[model samples]
Target: MRRGGAATRPSLARDTGLSKPTVGQALLDLEQDGLVRPAGRTSSGPGRTAVLYEADPAAGHVLGIDIGRGRLRLAVADLAGTVVAKVDEPNRCRSASALVRTVHDLATGVVAQAGMTLSDVVKTVVGSPGVPDRGGRMLHLAPNLPGWGRRGLLDELEAVLGPGLLVENDANLAAVGERDQGAARGVDVFVCVNVGTGIGMGIVVDGQLFRGAHGAAGEVGYLPYGWTDTDSEGWTPSTPGILEQAAAANSVVKLAKEHGVRNASSAREVFQLARQGDACARAVVEQEATKLAFLVASVSAVIDPELVLLVGGIGSNTDLLIDPLEKAVREISPLSPRIAPGELGEDAVLTGAIATALRAAQDIVFDRRGENLVTQRSGVNA
Candidate 1:
């Protein structure tokens, strides 16, 4: 519905089999309200150049917030889905109320940087590490954050930011973000899996994000499968369990202790040691890759997506994952989906939030077109 990105009304009408007059009228309605504008005249043919209209990139602004385990991000974007400004900082709040307040303050600063106000902001989208209710508030069971699943969280957000705000799972937003303006541009059905301090997935089907009943469809981190002692045929049972629990940056640090590799503080250091031919580090990475491959295989069997987009701090590093992950999936499934690292890097979720807000606002105009046509037909009959 947001017309700025691609295609024109005349071309759209031809594709939809609708009369040019109908399309022109719809375009006029959208333009009158400062939503879309005449960008320029098309140079196809001679008589009269048709004026091309696009969604006005400056019509309104949107704010996106991604709250992670130890960090918080705030970004302001235009209708063109371009991030205009952003802020990232470590969260110092200990309670949900304090976090909400901090977010509100950050939003205010972001808007000011964008040379706008809350009234100029069409909407705000927040992405957290847990499932949000249908109404887009109150995270339910975000294990990374203590006491996050309590009730009234939505009410609190509304009370602080006003209303009509959207809250989404970070992985879900990452998936949507990738499809909208990131690596999975033409992919309609794909799963976006983020590997970081924790693991999670976002499912996109039929060009729309598929949020299951209760809004927690892609919770792959707690898939409940684990590695056991002793090798069993093709699969190594005793190697490691879920990659997030065993190979995540945090997990790698924890696993290092068991190997008597003391004073290793970060996942980066573990990878560095592996490259240096440290026995313990190579074992850790291989063990992690094997577990990840199994998880990818399971996801492929269930989703059968065209592609599986890997993201987050760990998944984006294709140098470390692509080969082993591909091999693992091929070992079990014949129809393995193409695996690729995230293209948008860390900004995928932020970009997705802006796209989400723009879609909601633009859908308003498209929804009215159908109703208006029906009314006109009824009037003509009368």
Candidate 2:
């Protein structure tokens, strides 16, 4: 369907060894159902012509929300995966109702801007920075935002959006987003490690986001690798943890200060100094890269992903860490995954949420059509 929906139908039928008339009829039915529409005429050599059609962009709209540490981003996209309108706002306020209201208002504004209405929005997907259950209760503690772990967050969002709301962890969404539209576009097995305010990983197995039994499969932030604030022999999932304290922005700043570098406030500052060839800054970055490498190698030993996408606040910008990290990983593991930065940057989460929402919309259409077909078979709607 991506290759000029109408013109490719005959080709698809030929490739699949199906009858051209059957494919033509199916396409006609799809167009009548409002899922496909004539796009335009395709130009060709002398005397040859073909009309093109595509998936109807106006079939419906979907809303994607990415709840970041300091900001909330909401976007409305068409059926063809184009972002028609967007809204971004600071999320300093901690009320769940307020967040839902913000999403509702933003979605409404986006729809209006696109000359659509609330009814046009088929589904909504949210990417929050924690582990949320199917019931919408955030468990396993969000590192950046406080009070996000409480239950009913999904229900509140759904109550405002009406129906079809999906809540997913930010990193997991980022991983799928990258796989679908960014760096890992054609890869099947991969993992995306988001190294920003904290470290988190999104695992993709067989081209799908693989959330383990407890939905905490890629919780790299809690992966204890012999580093912790308190003296302990073994570190468990319930431990205080070390990734956030050792490699996060705040940790970078503190480590810089300990090395007599004063007033280094953020990770960007540290990276800038390192770029300028400051010995202390270079040393700090190298140390952090080593730790990150060890973490990745450990994950690879278990998941054995083909590629690893690096995303989030620090990971997106710190491509310099790759060379050193790769070398470090070679010492611990025989297999090294191809590591790359996410092409979509911070937008990965938003794009992924939109993809998820679009999938839900497609499911809705299929289910309703199936039910209608059943009714017709029974002479109920006939």
> What TM-score would every model get versus the actual structure?
0.79, 0.83
User: Per-residue error at 38 for model 2, in Å?
Assistant: 2.3
Instruction: Assess each prediction's global lDDT (C-alpha) against the native.
Output: 0.75, 0.76
Candidate 2 vs. true structure, TM-score? 0.83
- For residues 1-382, could you state the per-residue lDDT of candidate 1 as single tens digits? 4433545677867876767767777677667666668877776687756777776777677788888777788888876667788898888888777888888888888889999876677778888887787544467647666556677787787666657888888999999889877889998899999887678899999988998887878877756456554323343322222445555668877776677664568776776777777888777766667777777888888888999999887777677668877887788778789998888888777777777887875554434544465356445445
Per-candidate RMSD vs. true structure? 6.1, 4.4
Which residue pairs show collisions in model 1? 4-55
Model 1 earns a TM-score of 0.79
Per-residue C-alpha lDDT of model 2 across residues 304-366, encoded as one tens digit per residue? 999888888778765568888888889878989898889998799998999888887766754
**Which 10 successive residues of model 1 have the least lDDT summed?**
231-240
